[model samples]
Target chain A: MSKGVAITGMGIISAIGNNVAENYQSLIDGKKGITRVEKIDTIHKDVIMVGEIDITNEAFEKKLGLAKDNNYSRTAFLGAVAAKQAIADAGITNINKYKTGLISATSVGGMDRTETHYYNYLTEAEPRKYIDGHHAGDSSQKIAEQLGIEKSLVTTISTACSSAANAIMFGARLIKSGQLDRVVVGGTDCMSKFTINGFKTLMILSDTYNTPFDENRKGLNLGEAAAFLVLESDAVVKAENKTVLAYVKGYANANDAHHQTASSDHGDGATLAMEKALKVAGLEPKDIDYINAHGTATGNNDLSEGRAIIRVFGDNVPDFSSTKAYTGHTLAAAGGIEAVYSVLALQNNIIYPNLNFKTQMKEFNITPQLTLKEKHLDVIMSNSFGFGGNCSTVIFSKEA
Target chain B: MKKVYINSVCAITPQKTFDNTQFLEELIEYDANVINVVNPVYKDFIPPAAARRMAKGIKMGVVASKLALKESGLENVDAIITGTGMGCVRDSEKFVSAIIDNDEQFLTPTAFIQSTHNTVGGQIALELGCKGYNFTYVHSGISFESALLDAKMQLELDEAKAILVGGVDELGDHTVAIHKLVNHIKSENINSNALLESKTQGCVFGEGAGFFVLKNEKQESSYAEVVALNTYNTLDEESVNEEAIRFLEENNIEASSIDAIILGNNGDVNFDGYYNKLTSKTFKDIQQIYYKHISGEFNTASSFGLWLGARIIKSQILPEAVKLNITETSKFKTILLYNQYRGKNHSFTILKQC
Candidate 1:
């Protein structure tokens, strides 16, 4: 693979854990964060399972050291916390030393606040502070402010589930084009009644644990999370002597163009994305060491993605698994958190088990990794497909 | 580096710009704080089955994209990128209200599905069956510029030959009411032509969509070449000009070379000074033009500014209505467009006549 953008650091806060180390420990211990929703008040709370973080909005605000009158939404707070952790992990003392940028992805934005005060904003005065925070970019703006990144190219992408993956891709392109020396790219999304009810209408929220690559798989559990990675150029990495976590070797995005919300029956978009990613990385399917599948466990996604994987790898499929059972489907942050997991996989040479799988999928002969296994993993490919038929595949390698 | 060309441009704004041949010859004047697009009979481009489910934003975006594709004479593009400030606000409003009013019961998936910010980009891709790179940006005022920058980079890198880029935002009743409460919408109605003179604190909020086919290789229909584009998330009064001049310098162009300037003057007295700074100093001698009075101010209103720049360069005519300054230039080679929202998310785009 070409000398790719170096991922100097990564940080994540999800239902499974609040930090990278905790998340890795959860993965090895086979601990799932799926449980009944405790934070949001929704009618479907009893019928659905979710990967909700145990922290409250007040706690997140306190953690970020923001004033009580601050307009930091749950999404922004989560994004700021994760981004700060990433900068620290990269061991950067000064943010303005280099031409740095921030690319954040979030579908929810401040909708958590919006939904809570939807009607109250019209009648009450206290909740009116969130009126300006309703858009998808507000959270991104807050993230940039928290990172102390001003006069920079800070933007947000809202491609639903694959948002963070696209953010990472855009950041990588910026680095390749010499637009910026360092970039903080990732996605953040907080669970909201808007999304909970929206997905409830789609009838895709599982009542029990999600089972990926299983014949009896029902649907997915909604999740809330924020994950960010600090990508620095080779010159910056060498100059700063940053400890590289992994390298973004290849990335590609393709539209399914088959459905507004569902993937193609044949996973044509997913296949094309993977193919283009491999071509971009100048690697073949055999070069892949692990596949972090976008297996939402939804009947449509798993089936379509499975067929697409088969078409890409044919008979020599890599050990693949989906961590959704542990963290649920974190909408836009799915790709970002999955990327952290992919890096961890490459760093530790360990494959995480796909929990809740009891039966083999009849549509394809391939199955997910069922147990935690230590193996030599040099390259990992992570997939993230979202609403709007946005499909993305990002490859992470141990060596740049 | 490959030069990216604006091969074709189309817009469905408050004015009669949808018909490319008519260069805003007759403006549809409006006297309202919340203006809407002069509706295009979407049935001409979209079937009833599809149009029935679409919100105004989706319909405008789809039809505008179809017109762009028709003008470019291309069956499909290598990529489709869209930018929307509010996504499908009508649908979002509907879905959100449904959850509250109906107690989160009996809600269907149509509105929620269409509420995603990327719905327009995805719909265009589905229509063209263009499964190449698809991206959606939703960063307030610079949303459209972000998409343009992304497409320009891809074309510059020869990663894609032709890319469909668009920006769309539809006003929602609830959203409008809320904005009015926040003083984001003007309190009093005023003539469209008198927007800048209104001395209002808020803008005449509007909704519209603009789409263009950008290609790496210049074609017969190419309007102008995209020279350079940059966006800043935050900029104070002290650094706005420095950043803009620095951006121009990086493009190896001097301020004197710019023949015409397009400024996003949305009539918000507080923020309009950002443009005035350039008008009073940096670009005092150049021909100045603006179209927010005609297009109305939306998050992606700058897309209309882009469309205006392309039209001015291609036709080499400064429309009397859009002219902000009396000075005239013999050449309309390079047009610089700058836009920002509430003094944030600033974008500067330079387009040269090809």
Candidate 2:
């Protein structure tokens, strides 16, 4: 297999931690960030638990040093923060030195602010500034401006929960195809009344800590967070002598086509995504060290993903776990944070425990890694499935 | 690199462009600031039960994709990629209003589920049972171009045989009202025929869907060869001319060789200067074409521009309604498209006769 796109740096901000080191520490200590909603005002606050970050909109604005009257939304704030961290971690002082681009993912662009000033925009002039930030691309544009990236290939992707995975996939393809020498890719989403009420209507918002792969798994806890990864082409890596964290080995996206919001009983789309991703990586199931499962803890997702995992790995499934228990299901950012976690696992030669796994799932005999285990790791496979039957799998390896 | 071909194209625009047999044969004149698609009989394309729940954006996308697929003589493509600026805005507005007006009580999932940006792409996949690669781009004006670029890359690499790509956006009442307050929509209603002449602060807002089937293999029905495409997040007015020249040179084409240039002049005086730089200097001598007059203006309105480009290449006819300049070419072989919105997300796409 050829050398894949090199991941020079990664940064993330989730309920579990504000940076990579903090998140890794929490993972090893078996700490979770799930709690009651604190940021957004919602009627379901008592009935729904979320992995909400502690930072306030004002605090973020202050940190970014924006003007007092700036119209930055929570989504844009989180995305800019995470993307800036990624750029800084990459040790690149000049952003436009090479042909660079940004690909961001977000399901809720500026809805947090939109929903807040929905009616106020008509009567109040102060809140009307947010009307320009309502589109899903506005956050990406803001992030790009924050990074000083100009007149380049900057775009946004929104494929529901699998959005960030597709963003990373597209970024990898861009580098592999020589479209850009460097690219920053990931996703961000802030908690909003729109999402909380939306999931509530679907009856998928768990009122307690999410339990992944449990027979009595309640449901997924919605979260708000952002994460970004910096991918560099092989030429840039060699010329700059950059420290390679890991290589994006393979990625694939497939549609379940079974339902609008539900996965098929057999996880046909998930199975195909995994199988195709492995093929692209030129690796076999036996070669994978760990599997970062898309165990959203939702009744439909866990079962469907579990079955797809079994279908791909057969009897000898690799040790796998879901980090959602620590950060909840962060919607668009789930794939991005999980990717960071997968890279951390490969670098440390460790497999994170599926934090809230309890009873074994009855449908399958397989179970997730229940405790932290250190092993010689090389390749890891990560799965992210979302609404609209969008399923994606991305493989990372220590060796290109 | 393999050549990517636009095998078939279909669009449901403000004009009567849905029927592939007709190419802008008749234009619908609208005197409103906010215009809607000249909708086809959606029931003829979708089942009543499924059609009832689908928002206008979804219906337009689904019908356009089906028609494009039918014209390509394929039951399903290997992947479905879509782009939208404000995806299912109607549903999103409904859900948000219900959350606020109802005090978050007794709401259903239909509106919320359909509010996602990928709902249209997902619905098209469901209708075709296409369990392959799927993606959705939502980057304002570049949304459709982003999707087109993704499909171009995959087809060039021979990763997929055929891909279905489209862009669709629907106007929401709340969204229109908000945009009007921000001056993104025209303050006064103007005749569609006088869009460019209006010289107003904002163009008339409109909504529609445009879909195309792209494949690596050229067929008898192929409309045009997708030569090259590029997008920029930001550009100065002065740099647009230089950027256009550089883009064409990088593709090994010259300005003199371009048969026609399709400019997205939506009559927004504040931002149309980006196109004016090219029309007044770089591409002044080439055949000039404009479509926003008939299609109105939206984020994905450039997709309609692309449809016109591909249709002209296939039929070798430049409708009198879309011509912007007197310069005429004996053969419509190469065409260039330039588009931007609100002075950002600039893009250029080149199409050639196959």
Candidate 3:
């Protein structure tokens, strides 16, 4: 068997918490971070809910120690903060000591600033500073600058919700292919008026608490977050004798080719992705002890993904749950955050409850694990499906 | 290790490049700061119902990919990977403006759905009904290079047999206006032929799509063999030449062996120095070619350079319109392409005749 990519450290900033420890604490304590909108001024604030980070832009700027005229957007702020924490968590004193690269993923990017300054840019000069920061890659560039990673392969992916999953997959391939020794891979997205109104228009923004795998489930609750993981090659791990958090054993990206915004009814793409990932990991369906589903609490996603699970795992399905109840659907960052949770699950031998799940859907006989459970886990599978029929599955293991 | 070959290539740019039957035999000159692509007949590639809802970027990408697949003689590919710097900015602008104008009331999902960066790739996959690997890279200038690297690695590993890779970007009025405000778009309109001589602060903004079918095995219609590709987030003016030498050395190539080099010179007086440094010193004797004068400048404009390089290697004909210097090479065997936006996202790509 081939040696797997080693994940040495991880960092996360979400509605549930600001750091890895806090997020772990909230997950174990059954704390939910979903609440009514507080940061953004939108007309639907009363009718819609979100998982917004409590910190403000000024607070983030202050924490990062930026100049008064710094043009870093919320996406950049969150990405840099999380990536820096990941670098420190890995206990690397010199970022450039080993050949390292940063692959960040984002959907909103600097849209928050763009939407705010769209009109102002025409008449004023101050907001024009942010104009350069509007593209999807700007946040990644800023994050790289903050991490002190220069003259390295730095890129950004934006496959909607499956972006971070793809980033991790690509990072693993880079390591496996001997392209780089160390790579920091994850995704970041901040709450923005553009996305808020975008989802609102799609009619997928749940007004109440999102309930995944429930017959009465509404749509998803939008959230903003950033999460990152530091992946090192076997050579680097051996040289440094690092603490391997987990092994990124398998990953696959598949297109449903069914719809633009919705998933296939039978989840063909999700099934293909899970099967291919398992094949890559050289594991059988029974080998997976737990499954962290891409249960966005949306009506279409849960059904399609649940059916896909049934198609792949068949009669003998493993215990599965969705953590969106805790942090909501974080869009592009969902996969990264969920990967962190999967690692935490493998480390602690715990299974987080699918929060807010009430009634089991009639479409499938299987139901999500509604409460926290402890078990001896060896392998965990995480699924993240997105618009444009993008389906991704990443398998994590305790052993290389 | 398996060898990756460019089976077929297609491009739709500001110039009349979509036909592929001709290669810069006729040139269209413009005297504007911003240019739009010379569009192909949408009905020829996409159905009327679908084309009506599609935006310019999506249409261009879909048509270019279709043509590329046709040239490769494949009904579908194993995967689709796309790169875009701004994505469908027009739809994004439309959605955002509607939200602001309507105060988050009575908004439709069409524009919002199409604004995603992967919509082009997703659309291509859907059209082909190919449920395979798909990805989208959104880094500024290296977006297309990132995609190319991913496909190259997969092909080298024999993980995938055939992958469709492309880069596309479209201009939106609001995007252009804001860019002009920041001087990313030239302040004054200049003739296309005078782009380099104008010595302006910013480049003439343009948009287009370029797609290629990459396979693990060489084909009868192969254009070129992708030798090596690398990208850097930052490279100073002084270090660019040194980095170029190091890159060639890493690939077991010598600077003297290179027959031609494609440089991304967008007529920006400030950033074009990145290319000028090579033209004057390191690669002074090599045949130099520049295309942004005709294709205009976009984030993925380097894809045009790649298209030109692959065509030259296959056809062994260097168009006069793209020649930067009078230096001529009798045989087009090995070509190197260097591109960057502003001063960041530097890339070096080497292509060889198969």
Q: What does the i-RMS of model 2 come to?
A: 0.5
Which model, 2 or 3, shows the larger DockQ?
2
lDDT of 1 by residue, A1-400 (tens): 4668999988899998999999999999999999998999998888999999999988988888889899888999889999999999999888989999999999998888888888888898887889999999999999888888988899999999999999999999999999899999999999999998888889998999999889999899999999999999999999988889999999999999999999989999999999999998989999998999999999999999999999999999999999999999999999999999999999999999999999998888999999999999998999999988999999999988
Interface RMSD of each: 0.7, 0.5, 0.6
Q: Mind giving the per-residue lDDT tens digits that candidate 3 earns over A122-167?
A: 9999889999999999999999999999999999999999999999
Put down candidate 1 lDDT per residue, B80-169, tens digits, no spaces.
999999999989999999999999999999999999989998888888888999999999998998899999999999999999999999
Q: What is the TM-score of chain A alone in each candidate?
A: 0.99, 0.99, 0.99
Mark the 10 consecutive residues where model 2 chain B has the least summed lDDT.
B323-332
Model 3, runs deviating above 4 Å: none
lDDT of 1: 0.92
| RMSD list, candidates in order | 0.9, 0.8, 0.7
Interface DockQ per candidate: 0.86, 0.92, 0.91
Clashing pairs in 1: none
Off by over 4 Å in 2: none
Model 1 bad stretches (over 4 Å): none
Fraction of native Cα contacts reproduced by each candidate = 0.81, 0.89, 0.87
